[model samples]
Target: MSRIVLRHQEKRMIWSASSNYNLQPFKIELEQNVPRMLQQVKETDLLGTFHLAGPDAGITLEQLQSLRSQWLSDFDWNKDQAILNKFHHFTAKIETLAIHFIHEKSDRPDAIPLILNHGWPGSFLEFVPVINDLTQAAKASTGQDVSFDVVVPSLPGFAFSSAPPLNWTIDDTARIFNTLMTKVLGYSEYAVHGTDWGSGVAYSLYDNFNTSVRATHLTMAPFLPATPVQLAEMNITLSAEEQFEEDEAMNWNAQGNGYFIEQTTKPNTLGLALYDNPVGSDPRAGTPPSVIDHNEILKEVSLYVLTKSFLTSIYIYWQNPNGFKSSYTKAHTDAPLLFSAFKYNIAFWPAALLQKVGNLVYYRNHDFGGHFAGLDNPPALISDLREIVVYWK
Candidate 1:
């Protein structure tokens, strides 16, 4: 296969050609001379689980087997590549990096400029399901039709974007993203939404670039939930439902955060270990197949596997060890803030706690959806996006 290779000389020339930002159309093409990734999936030796069954014991052996079987027999990267190409993809040279993003604009003249951000174990691919709907106009409470000129970018060191320096953190990402929207794409002001680490970037944008980031919406907060001691000191109370949510969050911290500690302390080791193994690269196998379609999950896994981004994607965790644990004092923003809480999401922060963080304008709780709200519940996610715009604008 003939690849669209940007040689070292060409890259240097392109970099030195202009100080101004340049946005160019880009596409993902299958690379040549690559080893058969599926063959490695076929060879992975899944370990037996402990006494607990299902996700409690980690990604079940059965789940791994099913995913491996599908990859080896049914998954087609070329077909998926065609689907991805249907969207408008672009790369913008900003600062010292080239950022890859999906820039889908609506035909309507007044469509809102909205930027969606994704987090670890997820990519811009998370928003692929709702891109078209978001572009279509919807009636806001103010009786105006609202649509989005949506932009979803692959964070630095993830997907096709250039890698970040060892000391880089989410703050740097926020600065560059602000430049990407205002400086590169020329959006004077835009609304922002994010989940996971993307929420950190979104919050930073709202906090640091309030003039440029008009409003902010997030599926989760960037800061860690208040500790039990802090909650007691503050005399805050959780309802039964809230307590249940907190318990679930505690369980997740206990069980699901091993990857967090590892990635924070020694990202290089874990990154190198899973770099070439698709099965190992995929950590979502344990999520019940019902929460998100296997095909959708496979799409992300495939992107990480094929693009060779598995190593870089986990760098955020290491780069910002305190990213999620930082105090909420610095999170306050002048921009209106909106939050959508899905019942099945990994963590929960009460409205009382959130008020200290920003100008909380809208907060909704959905009975459906989970961590990957974009994939788990696009309709609810889309509705929330439309509804929140009404409050912020």
Candidate 2:
């Protein structure tokens, strides 16, 4: 395990907390950072490879060339920055860290306060496409208008947010975010939604701050994947579609988890090596173009490069390598728990496996969409959230 030791003076300067902790307006600025990123992209030398085929083989040379070419010519960071700036961005000092978040309020006075969280290799950009939709009123199945005061925060150590202290887990994040919602933002209670690592924080928020957290929704769970032996012992049968999803998960465990191992055990080595390397910092691939287009993928890589926080962003894995070790049966919460399981997500947990996670009130298995639900299928994600928020206590 790597340790970040700060001197007393350094700790005083870095860990300084604001007396008022006011919310200050923030904007995405990349004037100086963009040119540096461009220069790095231009200077990259593609490594020769002779390996296996398919996703298991990792990114192909052609894909790297295409991404580099796009970053140089077609991809415009300014335009993407402007698009991101369209939303209302703000930052507030919470305890020891300054948190950057998008606080888009609905016009309706009765709009529910909701916080959307993103995970590793993802920034606040994941919710950009759906924030506007989430703020507007949607007609629910019961003919009632459903709108939300949407807040999306960059996780600690992510782009635009300060790095967390050593050994800071998602539970620590949940504590700070609960304060962001109830104390700083002055929301008495708020709904919660998360995917990937965000789901772990959401679960903690739901479990610990149940008084302030009204309801919770998740596209992913933090529990360990159930084994074939466990499923067989339980006599749980899988549908043909589910069997495919299972096979996909098995493949990911075998081939796609290299980054996880690196991040979990040797974050310091990997993070420093890839500090100025944008191509090396790109997020997960293998999603179809229809789910997340090439430009969108580049946008994420650009954020990591411009902010220079790829190192900090990966520290969560090191801080809590066993975050997913909890069993589904052990995760208990009284709040209304809704899970939207997309078929193509990295791991698929049927309702049967997830029902034990909490007081599950609503569970939907979407035939489409993947890990990045908001980017993959905004309409379905929006629809699912709007429909499920009605069941909030």
RMSD of each: 7.5, 8.4
After superposition, which runs of candidate 2 have C-alpha atoms over 4 Å from their true positions?
Answer: 1-19, 48-55, 274-291, 329-332
lDDT of each: 0.78, 0.79
Top TM-score model: 2
Which residue pairs clash in candidate 1? none
**Model 1 alpha-carbon miss at residue 297, Å:** 1.7
lDDT of 1 by residue, 1-393 (tens): 111132233235434442476778898886441246776777776664443477665676676668767777887777878889999998988889999999898876566778999998889988888899999988866776788889999999988898989899999999999888776666666899999999999999988998878888999999897766677788889877677667767777777777878989998888876622222121343343323656666778877877788888888898898998557774545678889987767778877788889988788886666788887778878888887567544
- lDDT, candidate 1, equals 0.78
Q: TM-scores across all candidates?
A: 0.87, 0.89
lDDT of 2: 0.79
TM-score of 1: 0.87
Q: Per-residue lDDT of 1-393 in model 2, one digit per residue for the tens? A: 111122223224323432267678898889678888899889977765644476446776677778888889999999989988989998999989999999998877667789999997788988887899989978877787889989999999999999999879999999999888777776767899998899999989988897878788999898876766777887888888788777777767776778889899999877875522222111433353234767878888889888889899999999989888655654445778888977777777777887777778887877767788888777778888896557864
